[model samples]
Target: MKDMVTPTMPVFEDMLAAHDRIAPHIHRTPVLTSAYLNGLSGAELFFKCENFQKAGAFKVRGACNAVFGLDNETARRGVATHSSGNHALSLSYAAGRRGIPCHVVMPRTAPQAKKDAVRGYGGLITECEPSTSSREAVFAEVQAATGAEFVHPYDDPRVIAGQGTCSRELIEQTGGLDAVIAPIGGGGMVSGCCLTLSRLGPGTLIFAAEPEQADDACRSLRAGRIIADDAPETVADGLKVPLKDNTWHFVSRHVTDILTASEQEIVEAMRLAWQRMKIVIEPSSAVALAAILKNPEIFRGKRVGVIVTGGNVDLDRLPWSAG
Candidate 1:
């Protein structure tokens, strides 16, 4: 595990700045409530539907901020990134809107829907072996070939700040929430969420839901060190990254507790969401909801917020059988 970068109240201010910068560029996804879920969980819940956000996921928020944050010279040259899905779609679309090049290193297992979106947005896609080493190598090759500035999938402060917008809006929408739960992958989303909730909803508990299969973040947080290797495989491909220095830092400081969910639990939660609420969410996104549903006592009688990270699953090969 690596040492965590401590978080502070200043991150809250940076979150505000990020909100102002990207608000015009991204959608203010509606906050929806479910009478059924409230009744079922014995808790009031607000769902931030980033699945309804542009590019069909919250990735666009951070990607747009990263691209737009680039200076004039850099934006003209374009940006490069490596992602399994949503983030690639986001960076490609963002770069397209700016009329610059986007070079993406995509894992072989990346959903077809996401790959097509990248191509449609005119991003140059480079296929990789679907492992950390391959992704890093491909991204390096693409960067060397094109001289495009690297825009990491997560770990960038701009990306973290932009991702934090979800929490800012969540707090503003609900006024006061007892707690907020978001799935932790590379920590961009959780880092951002903690930054805002720490200030506006200081009393609010911040919980990160993670898959037990890919539980590096969970292990690292408990050990108070960063884990950068042996990222165990998970069906939730989106939550595959090892702990990052910046994100682990924020998690150690602001996040209250990291919860673990089984792959079966995540799939069950996804099925429940599609059937009960008619909202399609990725397995990674389902971890947050799984935490809420499978463990009612934790959120019972409290106002809880959940982030619907994405809905861009491949129709032909969804992680779980819909039938």
Candidate 2:
């Protein structure tokens, strides 16, 4: 396999540009507060509800930016990417808006709901084994065959800049936050938070949440280098991938800590949000909340921003339900 080229690190200006470019396509998703969750976590939690976003996830912000920023010639051939779910559907949604072909390389084992959503968004799917190697290999073939522009799920600078816009809105929604937390997979959202907050909310502490079963990001932070796991089993399907250089650049520098929650804790958080907060958030989004609940001392007494990354769930297979 050839080395993936690392795009230049995105700056605050790039995030601003991305926000302006994608605003027409994306909703300025609301920030909601839950008194029950606040009382439980002992912190003033503001949930930036990207779950209500277009394509049902925060990935749309990045996907739209990448898809729309393409030149006419490049876009004529359309776009291609490999994602477990959210990014795939998001890119498809964006491409559909532009009336372009969107090819997706998805894991054969990815949630059926996500796969269905991707197809519903008009993305052409080619299934691969649920591993980084298989995903990349399949995506390479798709890209070559179609001659489409490649839009990496989290690693690309365009995607990171687009994701950073979420924090920009969060800082604006809440006057000033003491801290902010979001789930980390390939670290796009966390890196984006770091990118935006490091410049705008310089005083705000940034944290990345992860599942203990897939704690590569936490381990990498402690080890002072990237430690990738090929395929880790966790309920937070969106967080299975490992960090790339571009995302690692921001995460390593600006994130204050990497926290983790167990699988049961993640499911509980997801259920708690649905029951108490009256919102539908996927397991990946719940990791931040679970970490806050698990380590109240870290968030207590602080006005914290919790990114509700996405709402997409496989209703037929709720994690808390018995098989």
Q: What is the lDDT of residue 182 in candidate 2?
A: 95
Off by over 4 Å in 2: 1-6, 107-112, 128-137
Candidate 2 lDDT, 125-237, residue by residue in tens: 99999877887889888888888888888989889999999999999999989999999999999989998998899999999999999999999999999999977999998
Clashing pairs in 2: none
TM-score of 2: 0.95
Maximum-TM-score candidate: 2
TM-score, structure 1 vs. true:
0.91
Model 1: per-residue lDDT, tens digit, 1-323? 01111233236677777778777778899888889889989999999999988888898888888888788997887888776578888888788877899998888787677777889878898999987788778777787777787777777777788898988888888888999999988988898887777778889999999888888888888888997557578778888887676777689998988888998989888888887889888888899988888789899999999999998777677767646
Candidate 1 at residue 20, lDDT?
Answer: 80
Instruction: Return the TM-score for each candidate structure.
Output: 0.91, 0.95
